[model samples]
Target: MTDFTGSMGYCEFQIPFFIEGVRVETSQMLVGTEYHEEAEKIDRETAIVMPLTKTKLQDKKEDLNFVREDIQTSFVQEFDFPECKATLSLFGRADKVVRKKETLIVSDDKHVSNPRRYDVMSEPYVGQLLQVLAYLNSKYYLGESFGGWKEIPCSTKMYQINIVDSKTRSIYKTYEEIITEEHAELFLDYTSKFIKKCLELDSLDHHNSKPKCKACGYFSDCSHALK
Candidate 1:
C-alpha cells in the first residue's frame, strides 16, 4: 500500500510539487534516481560468506564471468519518446554476463531466505524483471550508439539462491525468466503510463487515502489523510 510516488530505491518515478507553500521533492518534475546506496544491508557474516560462495560457484561453472568484473558496477539508461516528447530513465546492474555457444546470457543473482522461482506475471517480481529487461534493452541501444554493432541473440535471466547456512550450503536454486519482446513492450507501456499518471497526480491538491498513510511522514499534513 506504499505510495509509489514517494518511495525511494534503485529505480524511482516521482513528480515534484508544491503543496500549501511547501515544495514536495518527489514530484513528477523531478524523478529521484538512486543506486547502490539503497541496496539491502547484509549482516557481517553473510557479507563475509558471499564472496567465498560466489567464487566457489564461479569455479564450478565454466564460461561464466561475473559482470562485476567486466563492466561498471552500476549504470543508468534513458530513452526519450519522440512520439510524445517524454523521457524515461532506468538504472541497474546485471549480476552476471555469460557467453554460451553463440547466445549471450545476462543474469541477475538474488539471495533469498526461501529460494523459489517466481512467476513473471506476479507483482512481487515485476520490478526485478524490469531491471533485467532494462539491462538487455540498454545493450542494444548502446551497441547502436557505439557502432561495430554485430546483432547477437541474447537473453536475460535470474538466479534465486537460497540463503547460505549449514543446512543449505549444498542446496540452492537457479531461476530464469525469459525477457521477450512482449515484456519490453509492456515495460514501455507501463513506464509511459506511470509518467502520465505521476504528472496528473502532481497537478492535484489531494491524494486518495490508503492504509499506508498511517506510516507516511506526511500523514499529519496530507489533505487526503483518513480521519
Candidate 2:
C-alpha cells in the first residue's frame, strides 16, 4: 500500500523482484529494520500483563478513569474490505498502539538518515499517513475483542526519528491527525482504483525523477530507471 501510494513506478518495478523472492535492500532499510527489531525485542521483554475488570473496561470507553495500555509493537493486522472488490484486503503493522486517557493512538515510526531533509514539510507524507490510517481503521472496526474497547475516539501519529544523531535530535517531529470512518472509506476507494489500474498495466512508466530514481534500491537493475 505504501509503495503503491508513494511512488508511481514502484509497484510495477517490484513485481519481478517479488516473483524471484529478492528484496532490494539499502543501508537505510537495513538500519530501520534493525532498529525496529531491537525495539520489538525490548518491548516484549518489558511488557506488563495487566488485569482489567469489567467496570474498568467500561470506564475506558467513557474516559472516566485514566488508563494506559501499550499494545504489542509491530503486530501484523489484516483488513478486509469486501465493499471494494478490486482490492478486498490490506495488511499493515503499526509501530505503536496505546490508549492514553480517552483516545486510542496509532503511531508509525520512520527512521531517516537525515531529519533536516523534512524540515520544510508541515506533516507526514500522504503514504505514511495512509499507512497509519489503515492500522487505525482496522483496529477501530475489527479489533474490539482484541483491543478491549469500542466506539472510542482514535487518532494517528507519525514519529520521524533521526537515525544519524539521536542524542541531539532523536525525534524530529510528530505528525498527528484524527481518523474517521469516512477517511477509511475514501482510502479504500482510492486503493481499489489504484489496484485496478495496476492490473490493467495503466501508467506503468517510471516517474523519471532523478533523485527518486537514484535513491530507489532497484535503480541499478530497473530498465526504466532514469539515468
Candidate 3:
C-alpha cells in the first residue's frame, strides 16, 4: 500500500528490476536500514515476552488498565481477502504497539534525514497513513483471534525521528469510522487496480513529476522518467 500510494511511479519504473530481484541501494536507504536495525536490536533486547494464555491475558489487561505504556516491537498482522477472483493477502508490521489504557496505539517509526519536512499537526503522508490504517483495520476485522485485546479501541500514530538531530515528532489519529469493511473493500479495489497496472506495465500512467523522477533510484534507467 505504501508503494502504491507513495511511489507508484518508482515501482512502475523498477518493475524489471523487481522481476530480476535486483535492488538499487542508495545512501539514504542504507542509512535508514542501519537505523532500523539498531533500533530493532535494542527493542528486542529490552522487550519482555509472555505466553498469551487466558490467565496471562487477564493479567496484562489489568496491568494496562492503569495509565501505562507498553512498547511492543515488530507487531505483525496478516489477513486474506477475496479480490478479483483471487485471494489477496494483506500484511503489515508496526514498529511499536502501545497498550495504553483501553486503547491499542499502533505506531510506525520513520527515520528521515530531516524531520522539518514533516508537520505533526497536518495529516501524515497518504501512504504512511494507509499503511498504519491497514494494520489497525486488520486488527479490528480479525477481532480477538490474535490476542484478546481486539475489544479495546485502536488508534494510529506516526513517529518521525530525525536521523541528524535525533529529534522526533508524533502524529496521532483515531479512525474508528474508517476501519469498517467498506473502507477495506475500497482499499482492496485500489490495490487490485495497482496490481493490474503493474502486471501490464502501463507506461502512460507513470508519474510526470520531475522532482520525484530525479529522486527515484531507477531514474537513470527509466525511459519514462521525467527529465
Instruction: Give lDDT per model, in order.
Output: 0.39, 0.54, 0.48
Clashes of each: 7, 0, 0
Off by over 4 Å in 1: 1-66, 69-84, 111-124, 140-173, 201-227
The TM-score between candidate 2 and the true structure equals: 0.68
Give lDDT: candidate 2, residue 212: 76
Lowest lDDT sum, 10 consecutive residues, model 3, at: 65-74
Using alpha carbons, what is the TM-score of model 1? 0.45
Residue lDDT tens for model 2, 87-115: 33454455666555556666666777777
Structural similarity to truth (TM-score) of each candidate:
0.45, 0.68, 0.62
RMSD of each candidate relative to the true structure:
10.1, 5.6, 6.6
- Model 1: per-residue Cα lDDT over 122-198, one tens digit each: 33355455555555555422222334222233333333322222224323444455556687696666555555554
TM-score (C-alpha, index-matched) for candidate 3: 0.62
List model 3 lDDT by residue over 74-124, tens digit each. 223333334333333454445555544434555555555566655453545
Q: Which numbered prediction scores highest in lDDT against the true structure? A: 2
Can you tell me which runs of candidate 2 are displaced by over 4 Å?
1-12, 15-22, 52-85, 139-169, 180-182
